[model samples]
Target: MELVTDQHKKKAKTILKWLITAGIGCLFLFLFFILSLWGFAKIQGPPPIKVPQTTRIYDANHYLIGKVEHENQNRTWVHMDDISKSLVNATLSIEDKRFYQHHGFDLKRLAGAVLADVKSFSKQQGASTITMQYARNLYLDHEKTWMRKLTEALYTMRLEMNYSKDQILEGYLNTIYYGHGAYGIEAAAKYYFNKNADELTLSEASLLAGIPKGPSYYSPYHNFKRAKQRQKIVLQSMVNNGYITKQAANSAFHAPIRLVHKHKPMNRTAPYFQDAVESVLQNQLHIDQKTLAAGGLKVYTTLNSNMQKKAEYWVKQVINPASDIQTAVIAMNPQNGAVEAMVGGRDYHKSSYNRAVQAMRSPGSSFKPFLYYAALRNGFTPSTTLRSEPTTFTYNKGKSKYAPSNFGGYYANGPITLAQALALSDNIYAVKAHLSIGMDQLVKTARKVGIKAPLADIPSLALGSQPVSVLEMAKGYSAFANGGARVTPHYITKIVNQKGETIYEWHPKKEQVLNKAATFVLSQLMTGVFDKKLNGYSKVTGASIAHILTHKVAGKSGSTAADSWMIGFTPRLVSAVWVGYDKGQSISTYPDSGYAKKIWAHFTESALEGQPKNSFKPPKGVVRRLVDPKNGKLAAKGCPNARYTYYLKGTAPNEYSHRCYKEKGPENGRKKHKGFFNRWFHWFH
Candidate 1:
């Protein structure tokens, strides 16, 4: 028995020796791995701690309009002293009770989390310490891989070695997202309560502290009830962790928290206009999205606050909100292309699709001015007559037949002057002119006047069958208003860096596109649209505007089955209004409702109230001649349709009217009319 016992003891000793050797080897391997990881982390260095600053946008009057954060991370860094103590306590109590006691991690909490995850067969709990969270947010991407976890551990150790406890807490608080596009305690306080972080009360702080765990799930703006319930949990954690007394926690639980009901004021006064300006900046500066968001730019736009307000007010008053009709308005200086006001849609909060700049719809008869301008370039005068009758245009060598008719099949069936036809929006006359001058000339004319949409070389181009944006229409009409100068529409007048250094400034480019005489003639012809007697038609397309304001104005009205448009301009300002449904549904079957015209009149009347009234200045080459409207000839005193019309030099009528002479008896015979230039010059003097 003694010999057996000795053998057993020897076997046990051998097993013990092997076990100790294995354990030592394992320990050495573990130490080596840790040392290697630490060395690698040291070589990698700490992650960048820079937080993106806010970019502010200002209007023409230097009033704050809006703000954008870097990469949508709306964070504002705050020091430890600037943050409320309650927030720190609540955050630490719920997130990591042993935050200050641990070097970089809490092993006890980590063990519990691992066990729980194993039991659930999924990672349902996170035991990351505040320092770990800060390390991951600053240094590592949010990945749940084992390699990522190891890297995070190394980064956490480095963070703990470098930063103090308070600094780690401040960094964590500032880097964490708190929903509603808010990152950091400062942004959370402002977004949720419209107050500063230091001004947050206990209830507000607790609520904000609970959001970092699951920002979207516990967002007060999305689910207030869930947020409050989470707040109760955070308060209980604070009590259990001894950060606050039970009584204090209870008081906070019952404290009434007044959350901001309305959307946090982002200072966005003209969201649509700001969007346009941002797009320009992106293209002009060749900036990426990240640079634009956090670049700390001070964008000075051409938005007039008063004009924008007037536009919004008029839109709300004229259109019913419940109708779900989309409307867009753009007002700009015709001389410089400085956008004064812009309304992209009816409700920007509901839908941010800017119809003014993005939506491409048919301009309908509003496109006729470009067609007429082409005709004028081809030797067609305002007094030149065309037969306003049903016409069939052949395309593809008669494979396609397009018969164009007037609106409601109402045609004069006889010759009509170009001015009267344009004022009346005669489809047949426009189509005839389009065929006479060819489609390329009309397309070129539209392009010169700032129509950027793709226009087909079809005959329907004359009747506005091509789609274009309201902004383009406004810009195109501005040529006539500015005496044939092509102005590029722009919103941002200047852009400055954060340090108030001018980085970019807008210089208006005035390109002369047409002769001043042609532009003036067109402008004068458009005035007849507002004068029913001058148009000599039963329905003047834009006559409604004449009753609203006494100022001299010229505009055109356009409509399709699904869209309605009214674009007008004075010498100083050009504005356009479009009303339609997003789904391409017709507004009303009746053409005379004139909803678009009424909205335009209301907005323009208010917008142009204090502005000076100016008229188009005729260039030196333009000559005024009194001619018979029936024929392009000199009129006698008794001529019925005699009116003073403008013509380019050398384009005036050279022959006297024989019919008018017959009506005025032999006293005004051809012999008496000899040397007609001398006689007319004497009468004019």
Candidate 2:
């Protein structure tokens, strides 16, 4: 019986030993399998993958305007040389002290960790070397298990063999995820310092190099106390490893964990102007969403921060916030299409609908200038007389009638100059002028003035009952300032890629639609109106705001039921200010004019403060001549009632060539120009 008991014990021991051996063999086989695969892949090369490139927008002077990024990280990439050698050395010492001495894993650390893990009830063990950390970062994840550790070891072996020490160190610095959306040491430095990674001091470098073991636990955002504690551990490890001195370690330990609050990556400085730049990016660059959002791009816009601040301040402090006035302000350089500033609304956070670019409210009387411009092109001048009267018109085959009356309804019935009617924004007189000049000609003239809206041959067009964007009207007004050289309003100045290559630079191409002579004469005549009526400069007796003879500025004021607008320009800056409600309703009553002139005056005065006090220079072909506005007659000093007005060269009416052939009465059969169907119609008209 004793011999049988001994035999049973011996068999049990043998079986137990065989089972242990089998398990050890299986684990070794698995490790060998993974290592073999890793080695094979390393011989082949890293798998192909698309690397994301970043983009940024900057101002004309290369000041950072905004950036495109993803994971909330605006990464400015750097090569290994870009960072200091201390950064790499510190990271190596802190992450894996025995990295250089080991193949991939340290057998001694593994043995000690295994023993400690076995003795400990809590199954926490760490055997990661620097190479193993790189392996963990690149491929393996936080499993906290033996199998994952084994995989990490195998991968680390492959990494060591595939890349050199410097390359592996570079990968560690770049691929290691730091807190605050930072993926690398370079980004981490910026995250903590607001400066480049290469700019880090020894203390800063050590602090950042200590984060990867448990970023959240060591993250400054989480708890500065814990971060300091972990940072101290890093300093101790560096000291124990002899990488840093005790004095250095002690100083670093006591140093304050001054963590910078990571800046939000957004170029919200000018939402409107920035949005305008994005529009151009979409159309010209044909960028995709992935590239725009995740590319870590820096973009520079054409906005001068100063001008943008002025525009926004006026919109906020003086314009909209003053009286629930929804204001749209657009300013640009007349020389080029670069938009200097744009304020779409009072607050972009409340609403992003760019009113300056999108809102097409009826330009009211502002559209009349184009009609007057058309007449100038078609042989009419400021001195040209249109019989101003209460007129009625039938439309839709007489089913509807429009008794288009002047704005005040009391017209100077006999005959008035086109200049006076335009200054006062006469609705009846402008409609009559439109009929005499032909609506087709008016539409053609509008296209020339940068009024791109589709035109209908309707009488209402003459009174500017057509809706036009404030941006369009502003650029249209620039023609008068620029002496008839039509410039299309543009927002985007240039676009740059992530590589600092200029994808596009905008050079505003100006087109001369109207002859220079006509533009100059029209500008002079419009300035005359401001001199007489709309000029807001009350203190200056002879000096008008829009028509300071010393400084030429010509513009038009317009109001729809819901909106009131004033587009004015100097030779250099063209500014358009629009006031209205976002929902298109009249919030302020008429003649209760809400900040039209005040805002205009404020903006103009403020905008022109820094610019050269230069006046508009009329182009070479303009010939200014005076004629009697009441009779379209060559003026004589004795006619006290007659007003002298300027006319564009060739636009003035031919002096009634046959003076004796002038018809008998005021209602005598007559016609004004060649387009008229009946000469006798004037009597009835």
TM-score for each model: 0.66, 0.58
lDDT tens string, model 1, 121-146? 87657789999888876665565666
Worst 10 residues of 2 by lDDT: 534-543
Alpha-carbon lDDT of model 1 = 0.82
Evaluate residue 15 in candidate 1 and report its C-alpha lDDT on the 0 to 100 scale: 100
CA lDDT, candidate 2, residue 246: 88
Tell me the whole-model lDDT of each prediction, alpha carbons only: 0.82, 0.68
Q: Which runs in model 1 stand beyond 4 Å of their true positions? A: 1-53, 69-181, 184-267, 283-295, 589-593, 627-642, 655-685
What would the per-residue lDDT of candidate 2 be over residues 98-137, giving only the tens digit for each residue?
7777776689988888899989954498877777776765
Off by over 4 Å in 2: 1-54, 68-267, 294-300, 320-322, 395-400, 533-550, 590-592, 610-614, 626-644, 650-685
**Model 1 residue-pair collision total:** 1
* Top candidate when judged by TM-score against the true structure: 1
lDDT of 2: 0.68
